[model samples]
Target: MRRGRVLGALLPLLLLATGCGIRSTDVVEVGDPATVEVAPGAQQGTVLYFISSSSPGGLLPVVRQVDDPSATSSSGTGDDGRSRGKQLALLFMGPSRAERKGGLRSELPMSSDQVSVTTGQEGIRVRLASGVNQLSELARQQLICTVAYERGQGTTVTVLGTDGSIGPARCSV
Candidate 1:
């Protein structure tokens, strides 16, 4: 009888100390995805064009961040040509310090202020002070890829010179 009383008392003490049969509940609320607003031009990253070290003179597209808001174009809407113009300006500026360290370089002429890009119904139209036909194959590829990426991939693009149409190319990458 004494042993039975001790055993029963010990069981209750164990349950009380262990918090047995107690339940915990927590509730959290999350924001709605549909209501989120993202501005295209105000984005934090840059889509820069560079020459590839591995491909033996191929264009390498690098999407990295920039501190300056003016470093890239806000051309996602395809309504304004100024966005494309901004992107072209960045292209002509050449590779960043980090990119040069990584073996990237720009083939496009740094002094070509006459190069301008505009969006149209068909695709992007690039006006070059220099003849489009004069551009090296790799240089042309750099222009095509950079403009295409900003305008939209797979979009058709044409190069024009003061003389006339240079050629038509697509942004395949």
Candidate 2:
């Protein structure tokens, strides 16, 4: 009985001691995450997230039809011929003029031209000129959520900055 009590007490402490270091993260709500599927019933457009005027700091997704009818691939690339880098470039382009009038805007500190992309089993890795600490958490959230929606809900995305790296993180929303 005594040993069981000790073990039980330690268990809660052990659970509390283990964490990813971030004590808490705000779940930036956007609507349902957009999943780009480029197979036989794939969506014929790309979804880009931007900050909305009404929702101050929240992300708003904007779907733009790609020239390619097949749209994107399940592997996070586009069968439409837009690779991950090209997709990221489109993100850097910001929302369209009509979108801006509707209140969608980007939070990225730099353009896609400032970053390089690579993909493997670990997921997509984006290298940036800014340091990990240099980016605001909101900016990081924007990147993570966009990648998560693009690649799939559970897909892991990592950003490597000149000073450091952030994530192998997934957006819960």
Candidate 3:
């Protein structure tokens, strides 16, 4: 009788601890898929690109479309538009492997002509310049000026400077 009484006393506590009695809700759809819409009067061209501090060379050609903002084009805007040129080069020179792997690296600063330069703990903040889409002529100019002014010796940096300067910077890595 004592054993039966103990079992009865533990049964309610065991049930509460199991959490099996909790109710669940059904999954429901929340929103529709995203779509890209192109604007009018956009120009098409290719831009050379590279990522900084990356090994094995990250240089490539990228195509971009400049929206005229008044044309009747129906393509996607900004990053979603189709390329008129070749591959888009991407360069990355963030924290080094040692810094990332060992967790001892500091953030670096960056900026371009299109964007104002701002300093932060990790590095400089960059924003898109006005009337610029992708790495075009104007973008290239701003990037060149910004890099020339902000980088330091022994720092891993990547840039698409005018006059074929990208080759040397990439080789430095």
Best by TM-score: 1
Kindly give the number of clashing pairs for every candidate: 0, 0, 19
- Ranked by TM-score from best down, the candidates are 1, 2, 3
Comparison by lDDT, 2 against 3, better one: 2
Per-model lDDT: 0.70, 0.67, 0.32
Best by lDDT: 1
Q: Candidate 2 or 3, higher TM-score?
A: 2
RMSD of candidate 2 to the truth, in angstroms, is 15.3
* TM-score winner, 1 or 3: 1
Model 3, position 119: C-alpha lDDT score: 31
- Pairs with backbone N, CA or C atoms under 3 Å apart (clashes), candidate 2: none
How does model 1 score by TM-score? 0.64
What ranking emerges by lDDT with the best candidate at the front?
Answer: 1, 2, 3
Query: Which digits, one per residue and each the tens of the lDDT, describe model 2 over residues 89-140?
Result: 6676878888888977776754645656766789778776766767666667
> For candidate 2, what is the TM-score?
0.61
